[model samples]
Target: MTIRTAFKSMSVAELTRKLASAETASLLLALVEMTGDTAPLDRWGKWIQGPTPINAEFPTAEAEEIRAQVADLLIERGAQTERLSEDSERFRALTAAATDRVIPDAEKPLVLKEMGLLDEAFVDWSAVRPDRADQFPVVIIGAGMSGIATAIHLERMGIPFVVLDKNDEVGGTWLVNTYPGCGVDIASHYFSFSFAPKSDWSRYYAKQPEILAYLKDIVRTFGIGEKIEFRTTVQSVSYEEATQEWVLEIRTGDGPARTMRAKVVVSGVGALSTPSVPELPGRGEFRGKVCHSAEWDPTIDVTGKKVVLVGNGASANQIGPAIAPDVERLTVLQRSPQWVNGVTGYLDSVPEDEKWVLSNIPAYERWFRVRTMLSMNDVMRPAATVDKNWDGPEGTINEANEKLRERLIGYMRSELGERQDLLDQMVPDFPPMMKRMLRDNGWCRMFRRPTVELVTGAASRFTENGIVDEHGREHEADIIIFATGFTAARMLSSYEVVGRDGVSIRDVWGEEDPRAYLGLTVTGFPNLFILYGPNTNIGVGGSIFFQAEAQSTCIARLIRDMIERGASSAEVRQDVFEDYNRRLDQEMETLIWSLPVGTTWYRNSKGRVTANMPWTSADYWNMTRSTSLDDFVVRYHDDERGTAHADDIYRELDSDVARTH
Candidate 1:
């Protein structure tokens, strides 16, 4: 039923029940803030004092009647009737009351931007018009989250650009990683782009197919399909110093290679694209069906077969519970344990009434998204900070870390009951959030099953028919699933990138560690920007979509500035790049990931924390909001040649968007 009439069908008791929910309470607080109607909030008594615990229910019939009245009033005065400015006092009050934390006025702006409450302040055409926009074309490397967002904004500004991807589809990680029980860890609402909200999420944490559908819908809605080149791979990117242009060599499938030149290049190939497979001693002669989690083969069924799943990280944690029931016997080879949280709505579906409210309300979706984002972002930050004076166990960084460790242990104990062996294997020795924490996907319950076996020791080597652990025990298995994670530390492995003076990115960054200026621009790569680069991935909270959008907007602005000023190329200064990396490294030393030193994908071979950003998501957003011209050396058209490229009215191959240079 539609939202307008859905409310009319609800009885008073049902409405009261809906109102009693914590989601309803927080949403009502948002409603009151949006319209300045205190009637609904006043009806709740002191229940709205802080973040209402999910267990809190309406006490008496009188309270139910008041809540029903508020619901009726809300339906009568629809959200479309009024709009709330994010900077207003009422909005701040709503934020604080809904979040159950006092946010200072100084931090509101950053919060607003991170929450997507602020306006699109990235581009200002009035200050610097896109006069030479058509002449200067841009080439975006991927058609994923970052690429799509960049395309959308560039389309809005009437800039000419082309999106190329190696896959036959979009959605990057969402498209590729399709193992059983695959889904987003963050709330689906906050996981999406802020400018575009989805009202039809099946659950709070959406599954992979639903998210892929969302991205496909975005492409259709924005009419970006005509400009995207699917099944096209960029082989190498070389900067032409003489012409001040980026020469990209691309090949589509097995077709012949072709070259395209653009004024600027943006790399949107995310970090987790490459799969990292361990080199087992007898992997080749195992004579069993072997597959990585990311590259799951649908044809190879594990029904009633002996399965040995390697790695107990995020992917392994998910795969074990999903395939254990059907398999004859499941052996989980664990190198180390992970701390998984039992979230409230992790397994629940989105109710009909919540969907109705979100669809019907104007500002309600934004406020709800902000509430979830704030809940995930900074609430657990303090637990990861190091207190210098306070001595703590080697397993934990500080007092707060130790307390969190105990709470997690308590949670594990409650779930597993007297199964000390399971607890010992499940709980990590290090503090929580040291690595990417896993969400509870029935991981503990899987251990209780008779068919499942949790092996604590690391896999020593592979045998002819099975695997051997470090303790010299052999377990025969028909199939081996490497739930081992991706090569996240290997940034931009899709293609070769050469910068000024013909220097390859691999030569500079070696095999693993990659450093970039602001995680967007490298020092020597002129006119080349990146999304989801080194030190940009969030550890504790925040969505990668949010980070990608921020980087896209920043790059778009810098490219616009160059196009407006008739500049041929712009490279981040070397000294500025070094100084920023130095500060970033120093800051990394203070984060929890650096302490209690565990082996994680977040660090490189040298033990440098390359994957996670040390600061809050808000800090990264503030740093990338705008570009400083002084930090870059821009080469104008005059430096490249006396005039622009001789070709006029250039048409991009396989593209509807054409440009005249």
Candidate 2:
């Protein structure tokens, strides 16, 4: 047998051991080594001797030449550098490394199992009621990632579904977020469909155009675009039990109104699409170009223009340093400092050879996908937790957060050089997990820019020309980008949802917080399944796509149960939903998102935690794999067959397969 045959025969542990010792990745790298094409990475000059540490220093005299070369490379690729650095080379390396490192060691089976990537997905895959055929029609709102993904599974089941979007085209967040510096923070390779892996990626962290292109590619590949009704916004959605369908009233941007009905309604509008502008005394009076980063106007030229970026969330963190290079002077106005942890693969781009391996090597792509998921979910899971018992500051959590703080501060001190004043202005006061933790190179590098100004104080009010700071300093600018972010605290609040007995979803969640049993179904909403619904957000921070897939699969099973039972809907038992939420809240209270100093969107006005799901991604996955009647009370349309669907939920299956789901 050839070496290929021998390598394939060894167990994963042995392969890993061989891989670790080789320095080269594996058989693939060895093949490249034989060709002598893989040069000593340093010769490329992509890396340099320590300015501080790895790559920063090039001989001082050569700095001008290198900087000019870096600029030329950046102009060719529309990518962010740390959102901090505009240089594409390092980010390219990270993307390359991420593609390599994304492959997991041992849990290919488990990762494949969770994602239904295995041949034996017969059990888990059967949860979607494809066999019920035309029993129910599914209507989806928002043609974004979550909605599109849900439709893909539904299509595989042969379930009739249509996707509606407010935009002129599909690609929800990816479609709308067309800002200059906008690109995905997640590695482009893994920030996509697990079912469909791409071997052709030009950038490690793809820009908006590339990200949008990926969506369009998926739409074409899956044949979902034809099912989508673009530029049609959902006006109102009312659930009707008599017919067991949703009354969807839609309004097109052209002023035409239409109505449709479907058994299931899924919202992929996402919690982040709507731009949340801060209420100020004088608004909209800016003479020059003013727009939210989400709704960026490409026509607005920032060259030589004084730009003022409001809000230092993810968008501003990226947009600030991104446009700063082109602008005359850029000023960033921050509300509260957000914790920005360093992410490894954000800048790394995958090489063509590695892409070839990921594509042709069978399990290579799957293992890499699993590895990225595990890196995001399993490895970083603990970082989101708050240890209240350990003695620390009111805002800061225990040793872990302190370590994160120190790590961030260390980076700040290094990046800031000798400027302690800038360091004091840059560091965050709130705990790590309070707000959505961002990973950006831009935040650190923003201060390093000579023309960039970092103002720590609050924006007291908006002036006719610029933003006025709390200390009475006016930030003069011709261009303003509101990176203030979205109203993520309010989930499902954008839609007009009327559940059983005319219970408004907004009214129900009024003044308190949003809660859902298993984060899939609500108690009052029977036959209604929500994907990426209330409290479903990963609190500790993981991929939402994982949660989306799990939730969609879990709900698909419930839908299957309802159809099998001859019932129109699935409803969580009031008590059961309440009890589950109680546990979730209890978990939240223990975490950092619950503390006094922890003022964030994760919590509501009443000091109740709202946005995040406190459980581990694995825990959430296992809990949602199948449904039990004990967790919910079902309803049948017929008066005589009341709650029959509840009984049918757990009909013991003859097949060992159904038992697992």
Candidate 3:
């Protein structure tokens, strides 16, 4: 039966079930929006009231007309959405409808990139000549989300490249983090890479196994697995000034180190590689199973055993609720409470029919993903901006921030019910978005359970059997799980990098405060590109996948230009680097993440915001759309001389020679 005929025969209950599914919510919402019918929306509103109103009926006379209209519209528009163009009426209408803003003509390119409306390429494939492809050999570090993206783009350009990852698998963070209830906080569709969109996600928020399986599947499908060298670690990269090549020292699984060469080196080593273990005194004295959330020990059994989970953060939040029911007693030690945002469809699985609609419908998945992308990231951004006029206390930063705080606190209170102490412990004093916004995941409900206890204090030290609080209270445990997050500030601290004249990256960025131009290129480090670098983490509202894709395209364009122009190396000038960083620092001073209300991993030890970008994902995408050669100094191997520029030359001696005093 046809879609229209099939829907016409369905009962109201069946129709409601179809509409209420996570996969169909966006499509139904879009239809209701397009029709401007409030009845369908009201019915949807009731559906969000959850299981009680799942059988809600559409009360509008326009219901049948709208459904048929939506079906016809999907069939027609889905066939025409083959290319990226703002001129497409459906594209423009969908864009305006999804964003609820007028997108100017000039902004269409950026919007298209952000929406994955076009093929993943910053430069045309025809622009890259075949002969030069072999000459532009590239090496990418890490085979995670960003690494594979870079490799895929480079391979498309016919550039020979190698992917090196320390782990024995494709997924970087996903491979290591096996804690129970581990899953992406972002919606599954938006969390994935734009070029390889998936329609058959089992869960709305996919779990670790599903995510890893997806990445591994991508690697297998794209044949990226052949180019990847697993269990191989990149130790250090030094620039050989004469050959203009990056000399990489690699160690593979306890073997002796070996050196390799590549004209370009891209580091996709993300910020979360190194796990941050808290410096609790006598930690080594604990005579029990000790493990961090990232390095979860599946061998250790937690059934009917007392567990002490230190650090109340994202990992702790997910781990707590998953293990709370099975453990005899659970203690969650927190230094400070975090603001948790409750998502409605957090625990729901995608239905088979909805998945079929997504996979079969041509542009349905893209538009739905576009709608979800805006909802997940763009909507919460304004709250991350500081409002100078309105005066508020530590609980919030602005009017928007205040409204969010009130809503979140109300959620906690409602979840806690009669347990006011748990509510008090869960309500955060700092503004939202300052730290990572955690998913509620029934965390407050977990605290209300009789088997669980929430302790708000610094962990002083570990005794022979358990952890001790600062107040001299001891919490005994069978296993100690450190949910403490990664060392975010140290982006590439473990590896050594020598640039021009033996200048190390540490020497430029210091031990902890690493800075980069556009969070992609570094000054004096010729042909070295980085993804997920300093100031690139979007805490406000965006995925690192978007950032990584943009950066990969940017890096690819730079390499293409270098090969086409016959340039030996291109490096960001010192002045441009300083100017970009200066503007970033100034802009960050006005954002909520940089406020002095509380501390987050987004900032460095010196209280500077290092890991987060100040701009929106769209802005960053625009900035990296193409590389401007004016910002960098291009060098040639045959010239045997450097170009004379104001920033390149030290004119102190020249000034003294010309002095007439």
lDDT of each: 0.77, 0.64, 0.77
Candidate 3: worst 10 consecutive residues by lDDT? 47-56
* Cα lDDT tens digits for candidate 1, 117-174: 5676345553434557888888999888989988887877778899999889988888
TM-score of 1: 0.91
Cα misplacement distance, residue 558 of candidate 1 (Å):
1.2
Tens digits of per-residue lDDT for model 3, 1-661 = 0123244455555544443443333455456434434355444443332111123233454445444555665444432334546676555554554444565666666556555666544454434264756877899999888998888887767889999999888998889999988998888878887777787898888999999998998887777788988889888999999888999999999999999999999998888989999888887788889899999999978899999999889999899999999999999898998998888778889887677666654355666776567666555778888888868766777889989998988888888877887777778788888899998888988878889999989888999989999889999999999999989998886689998888999888887888999998899899999989989987877677788788888888778766655566889988889999999998998888787767798888888898888887777887887446557888767655665332343332234322321
Judge candidate 1 against the unseen true structure and give its global Cα lDDT, from 0 to 1: 0.77
What ranges in model 3 sit over 4 Å off? 1-64, 70-84, 104-107, 114-116, 119-123, 126-130, 644-661
* Order of models, best TM-score first: 1, 3, 2
**For this target, which candidate reaches the highest TM-score against the unseen true structure?**
1
lDDT of 2 by residue, 465-493 (tens): 88798889989889878888777767776
Tell me how candidate 3 scores on lDDT.
0.77
TM-score-better candidate, 2 vs 3: 3
